[model samples]
Target: MAATKGSLSINSENIFPIIKKWLYSDHDIFFRELISNGCDAITKLKKLSLIGEYEFKDDEESELKVQVIANAKDKTLTFIDNGIGMTAEEIDEYINQIAFSGAEAFLEQYKDKTNEDQIIGHFGLGFYSAFMVADRVTIESLSYKEGSKAVKWECENGLEFSMDDCDKTDRGTKITLYLNDDSLEFANEFKAREIIHKYCSFMPVEIFLSNPNAEPEYDTIPESEVTDKDTVIETIVEEAKTEEKENEDGTKEVVEVSPATTKAKILKRPKSISNPVPLWTKHPNECTEEEYRQFYHEVFMDYKEPLFWIHLNMDYPFNLKGILYFPKINTEFESVEGVIKLYNNQVFIADNIKEVIPEFLMVLKGVIDCPDLPLNVSRSALQNDGFVKKISDYITKKVADKLSGMCKTDKENYEKYWDDISPFIKYGCLKDEKFCEKMSDYVLFKNIDDKFLTFKECLEKNKEAHENTIFYTTDPVQQSQYINMYRNENIDVVILKDAIDQPFITQLEQKNENVKFVRIDAELTNTFKEEVNEDELKEMTDKLTEAFKKALNRDTLDVKVEKMKDSSISSMITLSEESRRMQDMMKMYGMAGMDPSMFGGAGETLVLNSNNNLVKYIIDNPEGENTDLICKQLYDLAMISHTPLNPESMTAFIERSNKILEIITK
Candidate 1:
């Protein structure tokens, strides 16, 4: 048949130029697109064979394979495939019309919602991507139909392409791209090999590239001289004697011995390269821990085994599969990097998927495979795909479930990792409401005694002692002295040290009724209600306030007296929790124009007991130097308990201590 004489009409005259210049950011993607198209054609042919629509040749080795050949001398790169080749008419219909998508039509016709293995390229322009790196492209193909004549199609920069019948017998397509001057690198063997390995290593079809420098294996045989004499030896002397005795009766049976030929040993050839199988596609139960560890090392190059792992497999709403490994994180939290890698169809999409998982969970290391991601034409394109939200939610739930399971089965191990993992979970709860709801049950709180307890357990244990209050301290070391005082009084205090603790506690306070977090050194008054009579408490407070003002010069100490529970004996200085927390924030932010003296300078209220002997002595002799010294010493001790004091104040306190020691020695 004569070549069809018809001109192709494009949506726009500049369409080809736009595609060549802007459709793909990377010129190397042209090879991936072309090879992907070849794989799709092969898949179509296999489907046709399976359905009995076409008769496949009865060849022992008929598997589909893609071959990439680089001819630097000819300045052409050829991509060949054993797929269902198109005829002259089919070429005129598909190749001539660039935008006509055969994949789109196939999907619309089949529409198997459950099958996710369908080919990815839906647009027919994948072939045209070659123009990005080629000045001219030619296609030679022979149809699968018997006696189908071969055809060739050629296209340059412009739309004026020529088609003609060609003399070819191969039953597949061979696309040869003439490299442009600037794109000659694609014709280099090394460069082409690299590009193929990066984009097509995981492709279903086997890809072959010419390796001229590869060494060949050979077998060795020992040299031997041949002897001309033909001799026959028999080892039948004993056997023939027994047979002769039996032959007297039988008279017919005779034994004959034959010599067997021996061949030389042959050596097996060594395998060159082994292809790595994608483990992300396999079922979790079928994989062993060792296999998972090996796969992790292959993908991440981390020799150390993971601490734990979660295999995520979900199909509803969206398709997702991956194994998330929690690597051994021993270094500072800030040093952890490149935790999660995103993959689509067993191909790595990106290593930094910080947006996919919550920022707090950034320490988690693993891969996430979601086939529904709307990758841009470049396959490198990442959009705010609607499916990403669902994927994120699913991952968050899985992580929460794993953590909850650990807490239930291995409490000690969970506690060991709690400090390191708490920051992430806290941040997740603070930022993601849904994640918080799922993770709240597993959040562990450590009390002052070094015991780990869940929030509900802590609340239950302290219900009676800490009525209408949830006391928590930010700095355990700074406030440890107060813990002893509270413990002595049978009050429970939780240690909350993270930077986010203050804000988180505040949020929890608002959410929970009649419950609030108060710093250990926040106030002189006890968190629990006082058992002393109101009249007696008022009398003691007035006397202690007057005596304290006289002992420490009234101008230096802005001290207010309040009666605390009898269990909290003598006296203690306290700063309001909110005020102290704000000061910490101000210091962190380095807010300028703020008065430094205002911070650490606020007057602490001093609650004293009139019944205590120290209080009685200070009140009876307020004008004495002994009273003044004791007042300064007590205040300094209180400051030391909350935070380190200035050098000047510390020196004064030390000097006073020495003087008291000298008096005792004398």
Candidate 2:
């Protein structure tokens, strides 16, 4: 190889500026890109060794790794890897070209002989990400070819780069970045180490950090100080009780005292930031509960333990390995983007990427490493290609399978976590039809009676009476009267309190034919039985409607009288299910810039109980403030029970109550 100079193959002269300012969202990602490229080169060497195409020296036979060297004085950061180095021709083809992929080109050249997925990097833009932090980058590499000379390549954030033979005779690649003034932080040993630990915590290769003139701190003490066997003592205390009763958490502690438990173990802390063998790389049977929890906290930085996790491992359809955790919902992170760290192999790419992760699943915190992820040059977003769709579908299916499996094997445990996980399930059903179909059976509801039942159980339990209808309540407090009324009739009402549930019900009904979910307060279900005939009810309704009109002065008010079994209640506000949905939609989007209270405009239905003694009394004395007071109170009671009262209505109710109190006292 001889000295040569050439301009990079790029269309725009401002490519480096675009890469620095807009290519990657975070500036710290330059280290990840550069280091991952080094890892890719190492993997290529391993693959070639396994295929018997290349022989490795005795030193190359050991474990392969990536090392980071940061020199603050020189303001330079370097990445070194024990992997396949590039020849002069290879550098001209791969480095000079901007978007061309060297690994992909190699795979095509050795299509019949090599495994295509062994390579970790696909985009050539990784090397240029260095320009985001540095003004100039240099590469010194010696190819594994029999009589190869060391080659050096240098470019100062521009298309013109020089490649020449160097004095270096190493068999691997070394990438050195001369830090720019703005990115001098990367040259700091502490900053570079922190960035490496954050992004390369679980990379497949062993990554060691080194700083010049650094003092070595030793945690490996003398063998005499270390104990070969350590005993842990345990104590137990029993609380005596008269009878075994379940706690609110659904667990009961029995009063029984046994021997103290003891265990032996060696105590040692982790030495490296990266786990060479990650949880996802191992089989589910081999994984322990403690290991899963450890990984969860380490990756998400979530302090609380996860409710459960799904281990995804598939090699055939596409190599996908991951651990998706169902974090306790309603945490401080409910509004934050979840920590679903996406990866290519073990190298992290991004978090909460919609193309790789289903939008609903993005609510979860986990890691998904798939070499098959079709990433673009920047490696920030997924490419609009077909294989990425398969990866997304596979993840959705795996999650549905996990939820369904847990329900079948452990009903008690499934219900224990239903409240926290229901929102995720409902959102998944609303967003994905395939997920809806898979999760429809496992979709659960907690009735007001504190019973957990799936969709089928709910339907079967209420089928004879409610008939293909599932009555639910969005606000337990506001709908308590209706809930109590339903309970008196031995009717069960499911609680749908999550904000997403309003739209989720529509999807559920569309998926399950002939099944409908109506809000308990929105309509009167068949649980209420009316005895009075239509003619008798209409005549009484006509009299009561006329007397109440003047008291409740709204001219367009629609009030229907019904003869109910419960005569204690005079009136209950009823809105059609259709109207309630319309109101919710309008309120969510806008009510024509008007106050949301106008949603009760023409859709408000006040169903008065004709069987109530108060209605009969009002109709008989239908002429004075005595009748007006009772009518107003009845209407106000219904208004408060149905929804929160507007300020105007609340003030009026207070004044009327005071007037009634004064009159009674006089």
Candidate 3:
């Protein structure tokens, strides 16, 4: 065919900017798009061969491969694949025509009964993504059809491209990119290798990376597979894989034979930079536990083995396979991105996509390969797609099921790992209502005694004693007095220390009626003493309330006289749960011109233990200096229990304490 020049179909105006900037979210996606195209070409050819539409030579290798070579010095990169290549007319139909996918056409025609593989590219624009990081790109292809002319197509960063015949004799396509100065990093061997390992690590087809600076690598295959004369055979011992047999006699004999050695043939193989058989791609039963752990270590580069893993192999709803690992997360709220590598038929898409991964599952680290996800002309189209939502729900359900199973079968281990994974569970519950519903049963709370109990267990155990209220403490030290008071009464309080805990407790309250989470230091309810008369109780309460109000100059103080369960504690000051949370929010946001002292006055309630002797003395002696001095000191003590006093209050308390000490000494 004669050389011809023409403008690309889509843009009357130059659309290179659109392809470069808007085609993919990341500039590096160009690598995924181009590599996926190569993989697609290989898959299409294999499909044709399987269906008898194309014939394979008896001597030809059965497998197809993709090869990538990057030259940092030349600032050039080449992608080559031995698959179903395109003729001149095919190139014009696929390459020159913007967004017209030949792979889609072939899938439409031949995808009815395809199996064991997937065709990756649906949008022809994937090939044009090369322009994202390239000043110019050239494609040379030889079609699989007999006697077809090898064609070469060249395009700069412009609307027009030239297509002509080339002298390529092999049946494959080679795409070379002349990278621009700003995009020259793509031509670096290390950078290209990183991108390939990120995007194409688990691609079904083998991918080989080559660079001039690196030493050549030779691949050694099994001896049984070698048939070529040029192959150099070697022996590799397989330790721990001995063949054991019983002697002719009844007795067994120990024979120390060298470990089984595999007969191997060596070929100067291109540097294969992909794990063609990813753990997730294999059947779950076939994958060993150690293999799953090793795969996680290799993918994440974490030294610690994952605590456990869930292998998801679903074929029915929409081809989804994944391995989600639960890593030992010693840290939380630390901007750590849980890497759930998303893949479309082993080609890397993105990690932890909100549309595909539930927000709660984002803390998990693993890989999910789903080819059913729809892709259009651009990468941005991936977000908010219906298929993505379904996949996200499926993953969330899988995680919930795994957690529920663990809690049921391995209660001890579940309790052991509860502390580490609880934050993730709580966060998930707060973010996703569906996940919360599924995971509510497995949610566990850690008590002050370091015991783990489920929400229902805690509620059931303390429902009668605490009136269905769950007591919790944010800081054990700052609220030690309150904790001690509760411990004296043999009451257990759960620890809510995480940033997510407040919201999680709020969610539990909203979802579960008749359940309440009250901070240990906040809002102690009133209970009348069975021995004391109602008139005496009311009289002591009014006297103590008037004394504290006059002494602290906060007339709004709602004081209560409660016969204490313990004889030691004389008084306790508490605040409403809502008021305390509001104060926390104000402190967090640093709201100017607002004082916590304003809330301090109205939010506080003083609970006086009437059982203590000091409280009896204050109730009996009303207007004397002894009563006035003790009342001020008791009010300050209760204030200090709720929050540490400021410098002025501290100084006043110290001065008043010294005067009392001087009087006692004299």
Candidate 4:
């Protein structure tokens, strides 16, 4: 045939520049686009073969694979795929037309034959993405049909093109890119491998990267051991070897040191960078825990083993397969941000796609491969559609079901992992209402006794003591005193240490109207008090309130005198649960500078134990010289117990304690 030359079948001359600059967000994405198209071609061939339309010869290269050959010296990168090659007329129809997807067209034509084959390309524009890095591109393809001649198509800057019959004999397409000066890095083998691993690590087709300019390497294996996919260079035989050795008893012995290899063949096949069939694609029962952990480590690079994981395999509503890992996150050290890789037909699209992965599940490290996702043009983001919401809802439901199921069936392991996974569950509850409702029953709280208890179990255990109220401690070390008081009274206090727990409990309160959460030091309960005469209690409270107010020089200070069972306890600070929550809300919104008094009844109170010697002395002698010093000392001590003392107050407290000690020595 004569050489044919013409401008590309596009209306505008500026289309190439537009595709190079504005079509894709990242230049590296060109690799994914071109590789995905190759995969689609191979997939179409498999479907045709499956339906018996295409026959595979026993001696031919029947293994479906994509080979990426990067030639740094030549400044070229080539993609060769042993798939269904296109005819000259087919190339003109698919390649000449812009935005016309060849995969979509083939799927349309073979709809009746194909059942579950995944076509990666939705728009033919992926081919043009090559212009993002290449100055010129060429394609050599031979149609799989009996007498179709090989066609070679070439274009400069994706504009004017030339087509002619070529000497190619292979029954597949080979695309070569003459990379531009600025994009020459892609021609480096290392860079090519990096790009392939980033986006095509899990592609449906086995992708192998090679540097054609590098020295060729080969391995010799037994002919019987060679697979159909291996490229054989030669076949040879090896002679057996024997060695003479002295036995333990000084007798000479002849032993075969190596066995003779028969029909050995030299083969060259680069290892595939892609795991075509990933762990997520398999049924849960067919997978092992070790495989799941290995997948987590490989995908997220998190060596710290996950607390547990949920393998989602669904087919009825929509095709979705994934493994969501509850990674063991040290919230104190590492960021709680988890990686959820989103994929289409095993090709990674993005990470942490909120449209498909529920926002709450972002703290989970996993991979979701859902070909049914409604991806937009670039496949970098998802289109705003209700189907995406359904996917997100399904993921949230799966997580909740996993947690609730574990709590029911694997109670021991559930409690074992409660500490590591509670923050995720709490954050999920805070973000998703349905998830919160589903997980409420399974949420476990760890008490001071190192025991895990459900909210219902805790409430029922303390029903007679503190009805419908849950007491929690933020810092077990700092609030050990308060916790001791609860323990002395035989009441359980759950530890809510994570920052997420603050909002989580608020949500819990809103959900259960009858329930309320209180910090351990929020108030002095009557359970810790010894019964005293009403008149005597009133007299002591009045005396102490006046004495403390006068001595501390703060008339507005709210003071209470409680005769405690633990007489050694001198003073304690009590802030109402309602007031503490108000303060916390203010801090969260950056209104912490505002006065706590702005919230009505939000002021803190100083509770003096009348049974203590310091309190009795101050009550009896309101005018005593040491009484003033004792008042300041007691207030500072109480402040330290409640929270960390400010620098100035901490300094003052130290000096006052030294002075008190001097007085005691005198």
Query: Which candidate leads the pack in TM-score?
Result: 4
Clash totals, every prediction: 0, 0, 0, 0
Instruction: Quantify all predictions' global Cα lDDT against the true fold.
Output: 0.70, 0.81, 0.81, 0.87
Candidate 2 lDDT over residue span 180-248, tens digit each: 999998888889878887788777777878777566433433333444332223223333335466788
CA lDDT for candidate 3: 0.81
lDDT, model 4, position 606: 91
Clashes of 3: 0
TM-score on alpha carbons, each prediction: 0.71, 0.81, 0.81, 0.92
> Stretches of candidate 4 above 4 Å error?
11-18, 59-62, 215-269, 531-555, 658-666
Q: Is candidate 2 or candidate 4 better by TM-score?
A: 4
Error in Å for residue 600 of model 4:
1.8
State in Å the error of residue 35, model 1.
3.9
Please identify model 3 stretches exceeding 4 Å from their true place: 10-18, 53-63, 112-116, 213-269, 383-385, 523-561, 581-601, 610-641, 644-666
- Which residue pairs come into collision in candidate 2? none
Query: What lDDT is reached at residue 103 by model 3?
Result: 72
Instruction: Please report the TM-score between candidate 1 and the true structure.
Output: 0.71
Superpose all Cα atoms of candidate 3 onto the true structure and report the RMSD in Å to 1 decimal. 6.6
Instruction: Note the residue pairs that clash in candidate 1.
Output: none
Give the candidates in order of TM-score, highest first. Answer: 4, 2, 3, 1
Residue by residue across 124-208, what tens digits does model 3's lDDT show? 6788888888879999999999889898999999467999888999998999999988999888888988888878888878898
